[model samples]
Target chain A: MRPVVPYVTAALLFGLGVYGVLRRRNAVLVLMAVELMLNAVNLILVTADTTARAVLPHSGQVFALFVIVLAAAEIGVGLAIVLQLYRLRSTVAVDDVALTEPPVSAQPVGRDVEAGR
Target chain B: MTGADLLLLALGAVAVGAGVLVVSTKHLVRAGLYLVVCLGALAGDYLVLGAELVAWVQVLIYVGAVVVLLLFAVMLTRAPIGASDDLDRPGWPAALIGGGAGLGLSVLLVDAYRWSTVTMPGAGTAERLGEQIFRSWVLPFEVLSVLLLSALVGAVVLSRPDIGQPAPQRGDTAGDTSTPQTVGADGVRR
Candidate 1:
């Protein structure tokens, strides 16, 4: 009964995090929201493992530790890329990035060369 | 309602509300702050579940490390601190529809699983968890360490300044790529 308390709370937290990740536009904030979601899942896993007899495998906590490490590494790489994007372009808006190079028409430089001649 | 139920409800409300605010707020920094509140409530929930080790890890990893990285990234990227003019997208209608469907599914799942009750074996402690981690999950744990190593290397590579570009002369320009480049109309090297 007491364990159910955490499970319900964790579920609600996970729901909210899902909403955030889906709704937010900022990439960094999206990552933060993702972290919240992962944390919520970790809470549920820990609670479930602790409360259940057969499911009470210690792997849940170990898996959670792995999640934390992975999250840290992800943030590091993600932020670096975002910073790079910000440097290359003036903004970090997801829509602003061009996955492929924008096509450009070659402008005639003959007139300027002729004038120089 | 029982004491446990009431407590859970209160904590759940706080966690949910804060989590919503983390996404809803336009200010990126403020959103990170709201995330902290949400995570802190989650740690509290972990405590209520009798998972002291997990609760501390929640505080250490999510509250401490992850959120700090988020704040640093926001600052480093120089994302606008004030409210963004562009908040919601035109696709919000589709998002609402999808969200509603997912919510309905989750509700159905919860109702279906309501009959299952969890029972603990003996007392679950950190020592027991450690024994299992080292004994059974040792291979996966080592693999995770390898993954971390790769990530560390990847981060260093990604953060490295572009090697193709010539280093900026000290008198003419700042050497750091973090600074914005100002191009002259004549296009002479800065």
Candidate 2:
């Protein structure tokens, strides 16, 4: 099998993920996009490992396994955060969660005035 | 191209196409399903590359556990099962960027390794992989386990904030809206 084929495929997959992350407003979907990107990287790693001329052939597979594990942990924490955000705001839209400022009326007037200085 | 080459090309096509669907599909459930397809095809690609252990692990972890977790989260979050109008912004900019990146990377790769072919190594068996994991890769594996444990605990804590807090009482206070309490038939907060 030609290595360039898989390489091109991984590149396209990563691009799709970047698009999803940048354009999708839903936080859960964004997480899914990130998963896509990680999977692309895994493909590249396994491909390189398969084609490597080294004595030990399992390094690429091992690295791919680590990436998979990390992706699992990432999705777990990400989903938990999304669930909590939904509970607090009743929406999973990324635009709704404003990290820069508190929700209107939720912040005390005195605290807002203190920050104004 | 040989039969193996053809199979690899087919699998790669399926993987990339499903990956695109994963990010572009409007239905959340369908998106998860596409992710499964994408991951499954990638596993097939690994099998074609003679990495049996990694292929199965890909199937077991990504398709079985991770996508299931995502689906559960989707249901738990009450995401719209159908096409969600509020889930996306303008598509033109994202499409442009994604296409540009894909084209650029493909061009770079082809330019760097135009006709180079690397011979396939021997298949990575389960025993060899296990030895490597327990010996040279031991530290990173153990650290990953710890990370998984912490992620489990953290997810539980984040999802259930009222785990250690005292249950609300009828006369406690009317101003506490932070906690979501359920009232039982006996008029006590559960």
Candidate 3:
């Protein structure tokens, strides 16, 4: 197969992933998008590895393997965080989890004073 | 086109189509299933490219372990299984960005390579992959193991925050006056 075919596929997959990551409000879907992007990269790597008839032909496959392992590790940690977030907030919507301080009007004066301390 | 080329094209189409479905599906569980299809098709692509070991690994790791873990999390978190109104935002910006990126990258790649073909070396066997993993990529392999270990620990810690915290004191009963335990939503004392 020509190399461009896989390259084009990877590019489209990556773009879809990027769109999902940006547009999805659910945290798990965002994580899924990230996985799609990683898979695209893996496809590209394997395709390039297959095409590159060099001294170390297996290098690209090895790299893809590593990416797989890393992806596993990443999803593990990411889902754990998501679970914890759900526990804390009772919801998995990313927009609701405001890491920054609440607006001044929304803050309780006593808690705000304690936080200042 | 040869059989391999045709198979690659078909699998690529499946993979890309499934990938799009994965991101666009409103049902969370359906999206996970679509991800399985996409990853499985990618494995088939790898097989067509002569990376046999990687293909199976993709099946074993991604389709087997990762998607299952995602589903477990979804079930555990009680994520909405059906369509969710808040699951997505306005589509235009994302579609614009994603489509533009894909088109631009495709144009660049086609311009760069101009349909040139490269000869594949040989089928990558498990034996050679093992040698390369142990002999040349030993450090990274070991490091990945370490990473997995750390991720396991982190996941455990994050999921169960009470693990390292001090246990309830001997006098801290539900009725104890000093502890001031509150009833949770499920009517459990906390």
Winning candidate number (TM-score): 3
> What pairs collide in candidate 1?
none
lDDT tens digits, residues B1-190, model 1?
5565576668777887887788678788898899889888877766665566767877888788888988988898776778886754454753575356446545654665563545544434678767878888889888888888888888776655432233343333343344344333113542
RMSD over all Cα atoms, model 3: 6.0
For B1-190, candidate 3 gives per-residue lDDT tens digits of 6687788789889988998888888899999999999999999999988899999999999999999988887788797767877789889999999888888888887887777777777788999899988999999999999999999999887776434433442223334454343312212523
CAPRI grade, predicted model 2: acceptable
After TM-score superposition, the amount by which residue A62's alpha carbon in candidate 1 deviates from its true location, in angstroms, is: 2.9
- Model 2 Cα lDDT, one tens digit per residue, B1-190: 7777888889989988898888778899999999999999999998988888989999999999989998998898887767877779888998899888878888887777676677788787798889889988999999999999999999998776444433442335334454324223223634
Instruction: Tell me the tens digit of each residue's lDDT in model 3 across A16-97.
Output: 9999998898889999999999998998898889777657659999999999999999999999999877865678888788
> Alpha carbon lDDT of residue B177, candidate 1?
43
Tell me how each candidate scores on DockQ against the true complex: 0.32, 0.43, 0.49
Ranking by lDDT: 3, 2, 1
Give the whole-model CA lDDT for all candidates, comma-separated: 0.66, 0.82, 0.83
After superposing candidate 3 on the true structure, give the runs of residues whose Cα lies further than 4 Å from its correct spot.
Answer: A101-117, B163-190
Q: What TM-score would each prediction reach against the true structure?
A: 0.77, 0.85, 0.86
- Count clashing residue pairs in model 3: 0
Candidate number with greatest DockQ:
3
True contacts kept of each: 0.45, 0.70, 0.77
